[model samples]
Target: MLQLPHQSLQVAAVPAQRTAAREDQDGPWHTEAVCRRDEAGLFFAPSKEPTAARLSREDAAKRVCARCPVMVECREHALLQPEPYGVWGGLTAAERRVVLARRRRREMELKKSASAA
Candidate 1:
């Protein structure tokens, strides 16, 4: 895991689209901040494939998420956008579904409590 510098929590502002000089896909902003990488024999490299499958990619993401600083924000974005592909917020699609279910459950519980009170 990369030890981020000690600075205030600043949300990374990813441009909706990349600049002409730098294509959206060919920049640190796309991969470094948004994707997980694995530490190989002696180097850290991004995952070869961006798509997620059953276990391999999930395992890789779990390791990267163990140290990601903006995991919360990432997950929130993924949930809100209903991203159909790739790993986001350190969670796979199925995991995000579980999270959404839990969140909805909690919201219902809160509403019930408020009504009873």
Candidate 2:
């Protein structure tokens, strides 16, 4: 029932239903994603999109993600799958890479401490 900026109510409803059906078959978390009812373009950049436009679009997409019930699940999925594009779980692809790197560093530190102990 939530309508996104520049998106019609009718447009929002269709994807919501599709996401619901997908959830029935795929899983429940996806059905609850706020992005499911929104346009994919809001989250993804087109080829050669302007820098300002891409940043604006990504910020809007992150706003939707901010309210998602399944945000943690979605973020974890993105992290694990290493999705190569778009804004996932409130993070840009670059942001996800940073997170992954930090995690790897922390893990290595822990391993080193364990081995030393």
Q: For this target, which candidate reaches the highest TM-score against the unseen true structure?
A: 2
Candidate 1 lDDT over residue span 1-117, tens digit each: 332234112122322422123223444333544343433211122344333322553565566665666556566667876664445667767778888889999999999999999
Candidate 2 per-residue lDDT, tens place, 49-102, comes to 667666777888898889888888778777887776788889998999999999
Root-mean-square deviation (CA) per prediction: 12.3, 6.4
Off by over 4 Å in 2: 1-26
**C-alpha TM-scores of all predictions:** 0.53, 0.77
Query: Where is model 1 more than 4 Å wrong at Cα?
Result: 1-53
Model 1's TM-score against the true structure: 0.53
lDDT of each: 0.51, 0.70
> For model 2, what is the alpha-carbon lDDT of residue 19?
25
How many clashes (backbone N, Cα, C below 3 Å) per candidate? 0, 0
| Model 2 accuracy (lDDT, Cα) | 0.70
